[model samples]
Target: MISAKHKLLLGVAMASLLIACSPADTPAAGGRPAPAVKVSTLATEVVQKRVQALGTLLAQESIDISSNVTEKITALHFDDGDSVTKGQLLVTLQQDEEAAQLSSARADLAEQERELARLEGLLASQSAAQTEYDQRQTAKLRAQSKIAEIQALLAERTIRAPFSGVIGLRQLSPGALVSPGTSITTLDDLSVMRLDFQLPSLSIKAIAPGQRIVAHSDALNDDFDATISAVASRVNPIDRSITARALIKNPDQKLKPGMLMLVSITTSEYDAIMAPESALQSVQLQHYLWIMNADQKAERRQVELGIRKPGFVEIRSGVSVGEQLIYEGFASLQAGSTVAPQEG
Candidate 1:
């Protein structure tokens, strides 16, 4: 039913198809097989345990400077950021009127005292009535009282530093009217600093006065030491935490009041089995780790964890020392899969 030319063309086509489908006698491009991946193992070791917390830096002592008397400020001796000694004059009020009153009071007191002395001499000689002598003595007492009142008024006009500290910016200038209890400036002693932090009430048992703490601030390049100075007797009902304070020497005056700092206190110490944080694997709600068994196969183990430190995590249970824990290639691992552990 076929012609000779058609049969010949068909035979050539069939031969070409068979050659294309035939298996290769040699391997395909890139002749070498992929090399096996190597995973490193880690041996657990005992380490000292520690706890960490965050806290703040504060000035040990601070106060607001204010005028106690109502008057126009006549002079200011210190500017913002000036360091002053205790009892140094800070502000002087308009006291010319008070000074004149003091002078008048002194003169009146002198005259009254002379008159009282004459009356006493007369009373002793029986030349003056007792009632008249008593009246003169009362007048002298009133004059002395006036002198004392004027002295007190003069004292009120001067504002002096209560303690040695750095002064804040002045709120009032010379010739400004100031009233009683008007804040003129703020003074703070920065030679020493304080850190206030809150701790869980449960940790109060382990903390005490005089214990050392470490504090860090992003503003500062280095960490500083602080000592526990006080602890609250009662825990805050809302937060269930106890307030604590720490004192730190700030000789350089680097630490300031209300500075936010990270504080850490060691609450306790104990031995714990820990591993690199990278070695931990989480499966659902539980933590796990891949370990190489004696047969050189991957095994999954559940772990109970405790406190986590900088580079390591405390293993409360589920593993022990001398065990080979898989540190890498965790994604490629399956239970019972063979592994080639690389030695360090």
Candidate 2:
């Protein structure tokens, strides 16, 4: 046990074991370089709050033109798809018989007027009894009433355009027997388009008339502009959404009724702090972001998420403007970790 050579060998073995057991310098602890990450300062900018939905375009004025009486169509005054002005004759039914009756009634009225004049003269001269004169006058009044009734019926036989519009395909042609209430064709004033869409009930407070709206149709390759014309007062109980209508001018007649359109309503706009979408992290069903503090230490912050746009997300709270955040290499970061921010 007291041999010098054996004791020297044991001391060397113990020193080697100690060196192996000691901890190596760790980059995470402090001795090595910190992780390199990209950082950006939070800035305020105007953000548009918008809602989108599928909508249907409607005509400014649309109606199904029909007839009041059942009869054979005698003539179609306007061709199918013809543009008609107000008071323009559109269709004429079997009105020849009615016109003859009206003419006969007018002739009878004229004869009765002459007879009534003779009866008044006779009564004034005492050549006829007062009762006889009164009876003739009553007959003349009845004739006048008959003419009025016939004229009314004749008017019903002629169909005229109630308003200026483009007429759709004619359903009934000449010589076709159409019943009362038969659909003749459609008349639409397409000078403007009305788009109807549904929006969430929660947006009621944010939407209003005169707000700007944009629309796109698969049928049309271009986008068009519109203005919010109305917002429904009542929310649908089943869907929990409200109806909204926007008006778009179609002066060039580019838009048509019943067209399918994608509508986007600009409900609001305001300044907000936005972060790059990649900088966000989700942990335990909660959203968080990595930030570099004044000391260059990484900190994890919980954030309330809002409307997200392309490449960026709105941070509603828990982040301050002018604060710097690590936008890259943040997945490997932890609280209190040192960070080297890279320039943009």
Candidate 3:
């Protein structure tokens, strides 16, 4: 069934097909060109372990300003939100009656002194009896005591700032009657802010007096530096946490009492091996990395992870310093595949 002419043509066609399928220049599998990849040399980085907590700010000194005596307000020296110095006069209540009594007492004391002097002169001349001179002396003492009592009564009507601080809103106007236990306003010393927070009992070792802390106020949109002032010796039984206090310098008086803020404390710090996040690959729950071995070939390694930073992750184990890992372009890589590493 075969013709010589047909057989010759078929042979030629077969030879052309073989030439197209296989060429002498076709590279062998073992000689395949290595893939180009970005690699990073692992190194140790000082890692900081920090803990966060919500804290409340309180003034160093705070008190409710109140009146101790029932009296009509004569003058209010401070307005709402006024800064006052310690011992500064803040209020003057009606003291007309007390002033009159004080004046009368002073006049009486002066008269008593004159009488005592006259008695001394009389005694020197033997014209006065000892009993009579003693009576004059007792009268002088009573007058002095009366004056002291009047002065004390007048002091109750006058109000003064007990400490340097910012005064709160006024509760009573001039001419209004105020009595004992009646709250007049509030006063707070803002030179330093007390930050209160609680930490777990286990973290007690990480915190101590004089330790540094940082606070962030979302309301003020600012950060503040603080130093630990006190740590609770007893842990709360209900929560197993201990309270902590930090002092924050606030000479600017920007921080207010009862404000909520975010606080951070460095629990510990140490050097640890860090791996670039880009080179890390995860499967299920385990993480792995594409490492470049000494032979310039890709090696798949399972690694243990710790804290994660912005662009790097802490390598707890399965990695060491000075090892090279593929930083990028490893999506199509296979174990044992040759790699042409460019430093990243």
Candidate 4:
């Protein structure tokens, strides 16, 4: 409903306000007071070519504690997750029958021994026949053999640790009958950790025993150094990969068995042109960076990158050593724009 003259006045005021609020172009773009940027020269650094793989942490030695004989558990010597030493008794089965047999065998062997002694004296004095003494000797031997057999049975009934390690969950309680092949628990040597991983056959030539690898545990949020202990002799026919084993020291017992770790293995080493990571800019799939020329102007260059190192990145192409690079304050710059270079 307003008049056309009033509408023209309102439009003119709005235009004036918009112009005042707009940002002005940089003074440096106008050929004075160039923007200052931090700069450094490109340098070469020795870097290792790395291959990544997923590895599983294994115990140095692991085994399931199982029974070899059918017997009732009479004693439980260790609890779940208990640390045990080699030859330590872990379980005791009902051995009363074996014990009674052993005692009876000893008594028979003792009587046989006395009879043999008496017969030996009689044979020496020419009062008894040699055949009688010889038969007594055979009787003593039979009794000794019987005793040994009983002792062997007792030994089998007594379960002992095969190695020093931490025991897993207790599967059988006291009085539980366990037969042959019945699992009682698990034992794992955690003093050292064995990491197993596979790599493609193409990487076989560069790997060998004693080479170093790095394993990172996301659960622990730490990196562990390990040495390759073994490499497979042949490649897997199905996957065309070779398995490698590395040993990591776990004196603190922080690393556990079956942990999934990210592994990094070095294949080769080479020198690379390196630049600060801060200077690189990305546009879609292409990467770009700014460099300072001898004429004190910013020059944008497309660059190829490699793995990132601490505080820097490897440059694969589009850049060379001895060139000055502007790492910071290049956001306000254009190709051929004047810049005040400051050492970074």
Highest-TM-score candidate: 3
lDDT of each: 0.80, 0.88, 0.90, 0.91
Residues 49-164 of candidate 1: C-alpha lDDT, one tens digit per residue:
44456677767779888778779999999989999999999999999998999898889889888887898888889998998877877887888899899888877898888888
For model 3, residues 118-170, the per-residue Cα lDDT tens digits are 98999999999999889878988999999999999888888889999999998
Cα lDDT of candidate 2 equals 0.88
Q: Rank the candidates by lDDT, best first.
A: 4, 3, 2, 1
Best candidate according to lDDT: 4
Candidate 2 per-residue lDDT over residues 9-82, each given as its tens digit: 99999999878655454455645678999898899999998878999999999999888988888898887788
Off by over 4 Å in 3: 1-36, 342-344
Worst 10 residues of 3 by lDDT: 23-32
C-alpha RMSD between model 1 and the true structure: 9.7
Question: Cα-based RMSD of the predictions, in order?
Answer: 9.7, 6.0, 4.2, 9.6
**Per-candidate clashes, comma-separated:** 1, 0, 0, 0
What TM-score, to 2 decimals, does candidate 4 have?
A: 0.83
- Better-scoring candidate (TM-score), 1 or 2: 2
